[model samples]
Target: MKSKGPPGGGLVYSTESGRMCPGCRQPVAACVCARQPARPAGDGVARVSRTTAGRGGKVVTLVRGLPLDDAALAALGKQLRTACGSGGTVRDGSIEIQGDHLERVMAWLQAQGHAVRRVGG
Candidate 1:
């Protein structure tokens, strides 16, 4: 499918401004895109669950339904990993901690005043 271009179909880069924002055609550093609020990915409640479906019987605790932006999500994921003393990564708006820490995660999130729910067996 043919995609629409930016307003006026302006240049995406300039020697004077470096890279431009495709949405605004302004220099990335001054683009209004950065100031816009991200659309929430889920309900306000955060869900904690454990799954061993992908790995070879390895367990990972998945936290989903957070309404935070990438930066805040990364920070929250880091704190959760540290509190659980495990390593993990945040991807696709979900936090994947490297072990089964559902209880720990739920408790910690509750302590942090987040509305948390458990999912899966």
Candidate 2:
């Protein structure tokens, strides 16, 4: 009796009993598919400032030079907002927290091992 083939007309086989490698299924641990560690980037600084725009001249904190990628910057912005207990957003590689949180945000960023600077009034 002829054995039934796989859906793509290929032979069906199981590697449940050491028939294949658990890492890359190449039957060897020295396979080129080994996992590599990610390189780390040094800590990045953030600049804080207060701006009056589109809000009847109300004060808003602007954070720039966070030196993080899009995803990392978003996460950092969320943390900063929570710490400041206010609303904020990440735009154009910068973070804008509502209200004037210059001192608060500066201290927080420094505590997180980031060098912060005050920019603008």
lDDT of 1: 0.91
Q: Could you tell me which 10 consecutive residues in candidate 2 have the lowest summed lDDT?
A: 5-14
Q: Report the C-alpha lDDT of model 1 over 11-99, residue by residue, as the tens digit.
A: 87899989899877789999997795655678889999999887899999999999998999999999999999999999888999999
Each candidate's TM vs. the true structure?
0.69, 0.61
Per-residue CA lDDT of model 2 for 41-90, tens digit only, reads: 43465768899977798788988876677799899999999999999898
Decoy 2 TM-score against native: 0.61
Give the alpha-carbon lDDT of every model: 0.91, 0.76
Cα RMSD for candidate 1? 6.9
What is the lDDT for 11 in model 1? 82
Clashes of 1: 0
The CA lDDT at 121 in model 2 is: 56
